[model samples]
Target: MSQHIALLGSTGSIGTQVLDVVRHWPGRFTIAALGAGKNLERLAQQTGEFHPRCIAIQQESDLPALRELLNVHAPAFSGEILVGKAGLNAIAESSVSALVIVGLVGLAGLEPTLKALYAGKRVLTANKETFVTGGHLVQPYLDRVIPIDSEHAAIHQCLKNEPVKAVKHILLTASGGPFRTFSAADMQKVTLSQALKHPNWVMGHKITIDSATMMNKGLEVIEAHWLFGVSYDQIQVVVHPESMIHSGVEFVDGSILLQMGAPDMRGPIQYAMTYPERLPNPEPKVHLDFLSLSRLNLEPPDLERFPCIRLAYEAGRLGSGATAVLNGADEMAVQLFLEEQIDYCAIPKLLEAALNAHRQESTPSAPSLSDIHALDDWARRFVREQANPLTARSTG
Candidate 1:
């Protein structure tokens, strides 16, 4: 009785690590389907190995090229091919997979997540943007939605068999990224390569940038609010450069329970894939001698230095539409920065302007899917429209 898994974003950092986990356990899990972006070569390789019953591509124009690669690489792949957003939804709604892993980045993961939950499939989500944007829509399905982010996964483990009411606060640990010691003046001149050099983990470029700005932590804050049924005030961000303590829960009785592990995405991926069942690590990387450890410094996140976190908190508190705008703005701003169109500091400024615009516009408290998408579109456009002015101000 193998558990079938439908993995979206099959070629991403998280998706590849998930495959590593599945590869370790022979018959425990199976890849029933795969949904990938534009990496046909890697997708074909995965299809050849995993032999999923169905596969999806982000663009229809890539289908012929994908088929040619599959013909040469995965000649045995007879799986039904699907294309575009419809294909992603088809994968989510497919009857073969019992669990769906939403590994796709940004707003792309939200609809498929909803489809999977509505189709009675348990969803293990690594995409924080889903919750940040559509927390209200996904609230009723919280039991079916599992968090794959390291911080949320750690807090989920700590709260097991524990009363939610008794929990006082959630202390999510951050690596403080590569810019922890960087002053405001230093950050103004931060290069693209410098921002991508995350201190602890290797992740996708978007997330790596978010980490550098501490915006990833901000997104996690909103995500934790939805996943754990907690308020913004109850969640605190602690800058722990070591990343040893994944996250912690403080109880009302003055006791704190923490889940500590090596800096690895596979740890949480494996845990979510096989919940309530802890298995032996296939390959242990770091062995810790707790008594001989020298230093584990923990401090508060600097709101002034990393204002993205502040923007995230304000957005989360504002409501659904604002969070959607924040996420959309961040995505566009990150892209602009990566392309050298905007400096690193302009990222947060764009986000702030988008949030302000969203505040001025009339927004629904509980927006529908269509409404979320509309808000996302507006935010991206707003950021693009404002990027030039922000960039000039930052550089001039």
Candidate 2:
């Protein structure tokens, strides 16, 4: 049976790749609904080609132009909708869609994710901040929460069919970004362009910078804890510069299971979209011979150099508003760094201050959706205050 899909963030890196998967296996899947940010032209083209039952755009003003464009060509597409809280709700609750692919960046993806889960749709997620910021709100509603990020996908595949108690530890691998060897003093001079130049993967700008500071790995650590029901200590981050071994899981029997593949998002994307069954696609295959598959190297991530990863583990262990604070603070810090308001090295420093200021809740309970929003607002305000002492004093 063909699986119908509602794809949020339809113009993003993961969304576009999802389209590729749909194109290759036309008979196996259907694009029932689609949504995107302000990329109207791409949205228009996607609507024109795929002819989804419904479409949503982030900017309300773009709706008229989009509707007109669809009217002229795909007039049967009378189902297009203006993307907002209601639009997200409609797409998540659509009866035809069995699963929702949420590739949206940052906290913007959080609400829709919860909506989908509550509506009883399986969620194939790439938005780390959703789990980082509000998994407590979404986890109980989930029947299946699949990972779309390669590392998490690798860990997911590795741990399949194994009892949670039998697992020793989950080893999440990172490529060490573009500055693996740079000293703390050297990071102070790094530019936005330098941080965006990721060595192993081509990803969105915010995530590229996060990788440089190891904040992406930090977010993933929290995500793994939520997704796998593992303790913070049970999850490990290893600096695997080769980028070949996606992730590994060591069991209680001392046997290690590893998932290795070329650094391609499509592999995992396809896996999640067609779970319990693998579909054949013409995407590039991993050729071990041409790349010279030598021995895999792994080492402990340096907490002194990549303190963001350390901060994430601390937040995950604390388990309250901590992950929410870490995510919100890092989001603000990344924006500030990109805008040249702060140096790359200062990103972790700002995140640490925000996390430290937060008082861990005693007898922590799962946060409500409102609580997640409040924590995000508080964390952003705290980070901005630290970034500008004048603002801090005025508020004080």
Candidate 3:
């Protein structure tokens, strides 16, 4: 049976990979709707090909330009073009699509995700921030969320109808980033270009940097807690420099189930789309010879070397809107660093400060949709106010 898919963030790395899946297995899935931010040109191209019933863009000002582009190239396309937050929410609640594939960055995906879940759509998401900040609130409505992140997806596959209690813990693996062997002093002198080069998977600039800081793993920890209903202590991050062994789940009997594959996003993306029924791999099948590669090294994450991971654990333990603050501040800090306004090492410093401030101000409980989003705003503002000009700071 063919399924309708709402391809949110259709122009992004994850979104494009999803399109690749759709393109390869066009009979299995059809594009019902699409959403993107500030990339109208690419959106227009996608619209021309997929011809979704409706589409969404981030800014209201982007609407006219998108319309003009669509008119010139995709003249026969009859879908409604919507704009801004309300538009995104509207698309999510449209019910025209049974599956909403969220690839948008940050907390921008929160409201739309809830809307889709409430609308009874199976949401497949690569948006980790949505889970990180809104997990406490979104859990009740989520029945079938496909984790598109390779590690989480691996864990999900490993679980496969198994009893949750039978599982001992989840081992989330990391690529150890580009500067895996670099000293703290060396990291401080790192440039944006160097930090963005992920040694394993090809990803967006923000996520690549997050991996470098191990903050991506940090955020993933929070996501895992919510996704699997596991405690912080049950989730562990290990450095897997080779990028094989996406993740593993250890059972109570000490038997560990591992999901090994080449570092390919499409593998997980297609896994989520086709669901319980496995789809044949569409990406370039990377050959991995375990015998020749020698041993796979697993080591505990160095919290002293990478403080963001510790900060993530701390914020998660603090509960409430603390994770929201960490994400908000990190976004600001990452943007600043990308723009050459801040040093690489300052990312976690700024995030830690913001987390501390949010902990002081927020209640020790899960926040509502509006409350979390409001806290997201407040956190961004706090990071901006705390910016130190001489050193790296939030908001370029």
lDDT of 2 by residue, 256-311 (tens): 99888778788899988888787664485644453677577788899999999989
Model 1, residue 213: displacement in angstroms? 0.8
Clashing pairs in 2: none
Q: Considering every candidate listed, which one attains the maximal TM-score?
A: 1
What lDDT score is found at residue 258 in candidate 2? 88
Q: Which parts of model 3 have CA positions greater than 4 angstroms off?
A: 287-292, 362-364, 388-396
Top lDDT model: 1
Model 1, 1-396: lDDT tens digits are 899999999999999999999999999899999999999999999999999999999999998999999998899988799998999999999998979998899899999999999998899999999999898889999988879999999999999868679889999899999999998999899999999899899999999999998999999999999999889999999999999889999999999999888888888998998898988775676544577658898999999999999999999889988898899899989988899988999898889889987898899978899999899888877888787766645654
187-250 in candidate 3: lDDT tens per residue?
A: 8799888998898888888899899999999999999999888889999899999889999899
Between candidates 2 and 3, the lDDT winner = 3
What lDDT is obtained when candidate 3 is compared to the true structure? 0.86
Please report, as a residue range, the 10-residue window in candidate 2 with the lowest summed lDDT: 281-290
Q: Which is superior by lDDT, 1 or 2?
A: 1
Which prediction has more favorable TM-score, 2 or 3? Answer: 3
Estimated TM-score for each candidate: 0.97, 0.93, 0.96
Provide backbone clash counts, one per model: 0, 0, 0
Write down the TM-score for model 3: 0.96
